[model samples]
Target: MSKLGQIGAKLHRGEVSYDFIGHRKLWFGISIALVVISLGGLFARGLALGIEFKGGVEYEAKVKVTDSTVQDFGDAVKATNAKDLGDPVVTTINDEKVRVQTKPLAQADIGTVRAAIAKEAGIPAEQVTSQQIGASWGQQIADKAILALIVFLVLVFGVIWVYFREAKASMAAIIALVHDVTITVGVYALIGFDVTPATVIGVLTILGYSLYDTVVVFDKVRENTRGITGSNRYTYSDATNLAVNQTVVRSINTTVTALLPVGAILVVGTVVLGTGPLKDLSLALFVGIAVGAYSSIFIAPSLLAVFKEREPGMQALNKRVTAKKAQLAAAAAAPVGVATVGAPAGAAARSDVQDTPRKADRATGAAPAPSSRPMKAAAAGRPQPTRKPRSKRGK
Candidate 1:
């Protein structure tokens, strides 16, 4: 184990026993549950689209209104007869102009809204460059964004598969990325945050970041697995575990560093500057960074182990290694007095018990000891066997 791997091992308790991707299954199941919950939230509460998609009236006015900030502009729009101003977007694009984007108003309602904004900022309607977008553009923008999302997924999975050369590995990594995205998006939907063009951009950025983290760990696994294709020294799961442990700390550090700026945006943009694209984009990044970090570590690599080991040959490899170890152990524990049961060259072997030998006397040649005891007397000393039972009658 590397130093980092050692630290992670100390930090996390390893699996007590092998279960053939059982731990990975836990990760997969949880990931699926999160996706389902997120999709449900998406269905329950619709996305909050900005003026760019909602086809609302937008105003870009460089009015030098004293003591009137973007919030003042929004308040001015809402306070006057255009009270139904539908969340005016105010941005300090530069020193002189505060670009305001807002929802579209009716032809009759347009004049009143303009007059109210002008009065609040104390600028004439001529100073405001206002444009109206029809609601039809929302559907188009949504369609295009969906198309782009699909295209992105295909490209991402393709790149991973080509780079890894293992379909299961690529698939596992992609699923983890999707899991992170779903979690982030679900939170956004539940929180009712605005889904603007900027939000879409942020989502793409996060996807790239998540993939980078996964690729880093995957690269480590690939390096470890080199030249270890056949032997059991480094199983696929072993390489993956080491890889995850090695990069886990790095992933955590990267996420924390990226989150700092996003945290600032959430604070400064929303709390200090009020509602804007920065706020929406910040919200998305904040959610994505956390989920991306999680999926890269616990979700991705674990899934990789599970999927890579799922093949029939790989399964057989694990069983063979286990059986070999067991056989060696049993051989070592045999009793000390017991000998292995075998014969050489197909010759029958005998036990260690010996038989008494019969030999001729050296001095008197053969039969020299035949008269030591009379043969007849010696034979007579031997007990006779019992006679068989006689018939009931002598017939």
Candidate 2:
């Protein structure tokens, strides 16, 4: 096998493992910090809703774009000062076109704004085009997006609960999902990315992707923890940790594979094309996929372990496992074959005969002889018996 395959095998067999469960506090702390920062960004620098989400008028002008093109066009639109025309958002596309967005305006005001932008671009008024979006339509889209998110979350919860038959796993999966969404959204808000209908679609798509990774880990957890209460070899946390390790490599591979194309799209949309639905969608997907992979490996399994370890059965199992380990340690520390000082000679000799073969059996992993005979120890300094030479008569 290749080196990575060998490592994966070792992880599956519990030969190589990371204590994701044991170090959950650290992970939780980091997640909390990131979430706090995200929340802060959302409150301080709100999302830049696209014209699809908030009703607005858009004007496109074919012009020789320059470093100051966006600023120059934005100034021209503001100069028109048409009724209800709020601040215009100006951006460049392909270094050839300038696009401006503003609050919905009257028909006469729309022409004036379009003419102003055209004049600034040194193009004919006919060359500049305009489109108006209504506030009611935007509101409907927002409501539907919210409704879709709710339905998706409800279905995810129901499916996981039914499949795992464990409320803790379901809850953990949801928390991880929320973590992925929150981080992705927060990144968008912080970066001032436009939240369009395509962005909403991207967000919904990533929820499924995130859930998929979480479910895989949870399935492994369920498999590892089955009938665990009857065994003293591992606690619930240990099993969960093993499950995380077994699936970590797979999650990394899947996330990397998914991100490559999404990353390309994001670069093309933002750097080459200069803003479109593709950019918006790819940004959400890229952030969500990475964060989902992280939450699956760290957040979901660790939280499940925390919840499971709190149960009475798991607590009892942990105690039993701990006690068993202590007993083995004590036994290993005690001197073997040492008789009590007050013991009788016969008793001491019998103990030696019994213990010697048992120790030998343990060391060699071989079964003891079936004969009910005690092994005799050779006396110190006694001459060893030698085998007699075979006669040549048979030849």
Candidate 3:
């Protein structure tokens, strides 16, 4: 088998595992550091809101081959001879289209800027197209985006809680979801990416995908741990670790398959197509999905384990599992043919409710108690009485 296949098989069979739940402190520390850094970037640097959100006037002009360039356009806009034009944002599209953005402007000012760009690009005045945008529309859009996010989170919380029947699992999944988004937005803020409607859409889309990935891991955990308290073979955390290991390869595969296309779009949009919605959308998706995969594997399960371990029942169960494992280890280390003594049956029963041989049978070498039903003579190993053939004759 291939190396990856072998590793996957080991993981599936619980032969190989990563103790995500056991080393939760380290994982929590890392997540805390990342979240702090992200929040810091968000508040300190802030995001560069796009024209759709900030409400700015934009102008696009087409220019034929001439002795003009972006630098010449910048100089022209700088010397626009119009008051309060402020700083202009300029981008070149396909080396033929020049797009310029500036703060809201009066009609006369717009005309001035258009005329300036046209003259600078050596293009006809009619080739310049100008549009005025209102801040109210942007405000409405921002409100709607926030509302949509809140609703999405609410629905996701309800769904996860209901499906898992465990609030801690749901909480962990939601926290991981938040981690993915916060890091994605923080990267955008740190790099000063324009926060556009497309970016918002990408963020929302990734939330669902992130939740889906986390749910997959959590579902495995639920499956592995069903009726876990019935035996001491494994603790809840051990079951969770096995679940994560079993699904780690699957998560990596899914993330890689999904990311390849987004990475392509990001590269192509930023490199080949220049600045556009594709760049904005793909950048958000790439960051969000990558972080989502990471949190699903490393963060969510660990946090869930931590939360579960805090419960009184789980804590006691874990203690019993630990003690049982220690006992088994000691028994194995003893010399060959050495009988290791264990705690009394009553104590073991009170601790784990596991089946143990009756103390009386062990002491006296007597058979165990019989079942409620009467056994047949042959089955019970008792010889059958010789049938009295004369009984029929006597009757």
CA lDDT scores, all candidates in order: 0.74, 0.88, 0.83
After superposing candidate 3, which stretches have Cα over 4 Å from the reference? 61-99, 119-127, 337-395
Instruction: Name the lDDT value of residue 80 in candidate 1.
Output: 54
CA RMSD per model (angstroms): 14.4, 8.3, 11.4
TM-scores of all candidate predictions against the true structure: 0.75, 0.77, 0.77
lDDT of 1 by residue, 1-395 (tens): 88755666653444322332346677667778888989999889967778778788877766663434877888767765553567677777656777677676777677766776677667798777777887788778878988887898889888888998877778877887788788888988888878888888888888888889888988887876675547655467766676676667678778889999889988987877776778888988898888888888778888877776777766776776667777888988876445557733322222222111123355435443333322464577787665556874455
Please give the TM-score that candidate 3 achieves against the real structure: 0.77
Q: For candidate 3, give the lDDT.
A: 0.83
Task: Name the regions of candidate 2 deviating beyond 4 angstroms.
Answer: 59-100, 106-108, 116-129, 337-395
Which segments of model 1 are wrong by more than 4 Å?
Answer: 1-22, 64-68, 81-84, 227-229, 324-395
Q: Which lDDT tens digits does candidate 2 get at residues 75-178?
A: 89999989988667777877788889888788899899988998998989999988888888998999999999989888999999999998888899989988
Clashes of 1: 4
**Candidate 3 lDDT, 1-395, residue by residue in tens:** 98988999999998878787788888778888888999999999888888888888889988642334555676788887666676676667666787887877777888888888888778788889988778888899999999998888888888889999888988998889888888999999888878889999999989988888899999999999998877777888899999999999999999999999999999987776555678899999999999989999999998898898898878888888999999999877876533336743454344332223456566788887653444554677766455568758666
How many clashes in each structure? 4, 0, 0
lDDT of model 3 at residue 123? 77
